[model samples]
Target: MAQKSIRYNYFLNIFRIGFGILAGLFTMPYINRVIGVEGLGKVEYVNSIIAYFVLFSALGIPMYGIRETANRRDNLKEKSKLVIELLSILFVTSLVSYLIIFFVIINIHSLLDLKPLIVIMSSTIFFSNIGIEWFYQGIEDQRYITIRFIIVRIISLILLFLLVKEPKDYLNYGIIVVLSSVGGNIFNILYLKKHLSFKGFTIKDLNFKRHLKPILTIFVASISVSIYVQLDVLMLGSLKGSTSVGYYVMANKLIRFTIIFIVTLGSVLLPRLSYLISNDKEQYVVYVKKSLNYFLIIAFPFTVIFLTLAEDFTLLLGGQEFLPSIITMKILSPIIIIVSIAYFIGYLILYPQGKENIYTIAVIISAIISVIANFFLIPILGHIGAAIIAVSSELVGVLIMILLYYKELSKLELISVNILYYIIASFIMFLTIFFISYFNIDPLVNIVISSILGFLSFFLFLFIMKEEIFLSIVLDLKSRLNQN
Candidate 1:
């Protein structure tokens, strides 16, 4: 049953990623046409502000709920009660936070032109706090959540095509996002209702105090994560301007989109890692090592590709008007590699051991460095400086978490020959792309040919290095195709 669940989660993730990529592809041109650069920057800034408040509103309830419900999965009554309790807490907190944010927006109406749009989009925060979908995640029922998102995203795409006709119709774009959020959550809530009975759920019997410590720890960690991740856009918008914010956000979106494969893999591995850590230490260590190895194999080549083709990708994705973000994208590309490694170290290793404080502290330190870097850098280097600070802080944070994880594990097998082979293979792939680009080929053709060669070299290197994960996946696919 667990194996089947894992397999289902894997396929669901593939579908989700495919859908996300398609959505991005569809939305990018429309957004670029409708909002233009400055307008897109304004929209991103407003959304970022609301996202920070949403993080506060969430207060780590989803993480707490997922952990507790997964731990108590066999106990239906207890799991349901825990879900109810967490939902109630999230509800109250979201309401209060929304009120405060709305009040502030109303009071500061003159300074911000998009207060109405922010207010409309803020409903996503309240709706998402209901926590029905997370219950599915805890029990490994990802198909439902996956289907819900897919349907909503399809609807969002249609709405974008229909409503987003002009550049100044930013308010309509805001509406599209809100509608998608509400529609998706509604579907998730309805879908989840079939699996668990919420009939007897009540807030009166819940005890928040029992889970206060871990909840607070996760809350602080969430805020810290948000600081380095989301706060940069807000800071860029404030310090530089919306035009710069648009460029930075566009670059970030492209880099982050490329890492979705890693992110999906990590999501699948996290629950498995949590289970292994609870049940089998030796297996947990093996799982962590394998996961990290797979990440390195996938992430390293993509990092090199992004660094090489940053300018072409930016021009293709966001147009020539977004040339300013090319440097930003280059600076931020390596972050995917580093952050993927850190996520494995932190979540799979340190987090399950109750060493979440270390993760929180690392993020806090990174956030501090980011703020200082941005303060000095954004004024001089503009968006590119902000991007540099963003990636630098991420690299530093990952280093800190890795050291902490190693200390907790009491050994370091991270520098093994396997990792060395992965690094060498990545370097070879980089050189392959570099040689392909050295010829005075057309830029677009160079990118296509280089990407093909890079991946071909990566697979050849993996074969030579005998990477088990790569080999296994290849053999499995080959066998399945033969059967078909």
Candidate 2:
């Protein structure tokens, strides 16, 4: 039953992430065509500006909430109290963040034109509190999250096509962007009634005092992390203009999209790992090992494929006019593995163990590196420079985290023979795809064929090398077939 539940969480997130990426890939070119490069850039620019506010509104509640809620899931009253208190805190903080946003928009001379879109985008802050995404995540009841986000995204996608018909419909497109996230948040609020009663809970029951310090600590860490993240788009928009922002956004989007497959595992596993740490160290160790192995098996190939087929991927996803993103995507591709490693180290380990200070230090230093690098590079290389800084900074942060937590991390013995198998598989797959693509064909067709052939070769190499993940999947399939 436990295994089944864990698999359920993993696969639902897989469905949501997979669906979101596939849907975006299908719709992006059309959306870009309608919006125009500059228009798309403007949209990305505004969204990037709003992301900081969104981050501030979020603070550390999501992570902190997940841990606290998961620990208290059995006691309905305690869980309810945590939810209300966290929501109250979230509400107050989001309002404060929104006020800051309002002030910035009004005071900044360049942002006046985007005042409307910025306001509309800011609606997400309000929804962020009501969403209580942490509550559901804590319980590992991701079916609701999966269904809600997937349904909302699909609706937004349809609305995007129907309403956003031209470049002038940038505002309409902006509405779709807000709907993508906020729509589900509304559902999350409505869903809360089924689980807990707000009417019975008073403000007196909410304990905001206890959570304040840790939450703020995580918030500062979040801000530092967001610095490097949103800095790319913000700098591009400010220094290089909207067209450059557009190209950079596309590349960043592609990298993020590809990362879903890798990161989703670590994300869904966090709560379980936290629980297992005290009660089941053996399982926890196994999960850590498996996460690392799966990250290599899963993330490595996607990065390699992106690196090798950057041009083809850009043309397929962004159209010919935005081919400048090809280089950015290539430069950013390898970060996939790095990001997975960072999450495994920072989130799965240090975070669950209450090492937020060390985590914060690592990310803050990383953000500083990003800022300095961007100052030097964005002016000279533009968006490509942003890509380089983002990747390099993450690498630095991961290294710092490893160094700080050397005693704990070293015991895990993350290096293994499976890693060599993954590398061998990925290398062989890359060669196969490279040779096949030499035929000179349609970009889309080339991508499709290369991915299929490359993945097949990857699987073949894994099987030959007896990779654990591949063997486990094969065995699981056999078990299911026999049961059927």
lDDT of each: 0.77, 0.85
Which is the leading candidate under TM-score?
2
TM-score for predicted model 1 compared with the true structure: 0.94
Off by over 4 Å in 1: 1-3, 109-111, 178-183, 198-204, 410-412, 439-445
lDDT of 2 by residue, 202-302 (tens): 77777789998988888888888889888999999999999999999888888888777677767788888877877798888888888777777878889
lDDT of 1 by residue, 1-484 (tens): 2434555687788888777876886688668756888888877888888888788878876666666666777776677777767777787888898888878787885436887778777877867776455576677777667877788888888888888888788888887877765557866665665656656656676787877788888889888877888878988888888888988988898788767768766767666666666788888787777778777877888898889887777766788888888888889989988888767766666666677888888888898888888888888988888888878888888888867666555563656677777778888988898787768676568778888999899889888778777888789889989999
lDDT of 1: 0.77
Error of 1 at 295 (Å): 1.9
Q: How accurate locally is residue 190 in candidate 2, as Cα lDDT from 0 to 100?
A: 75
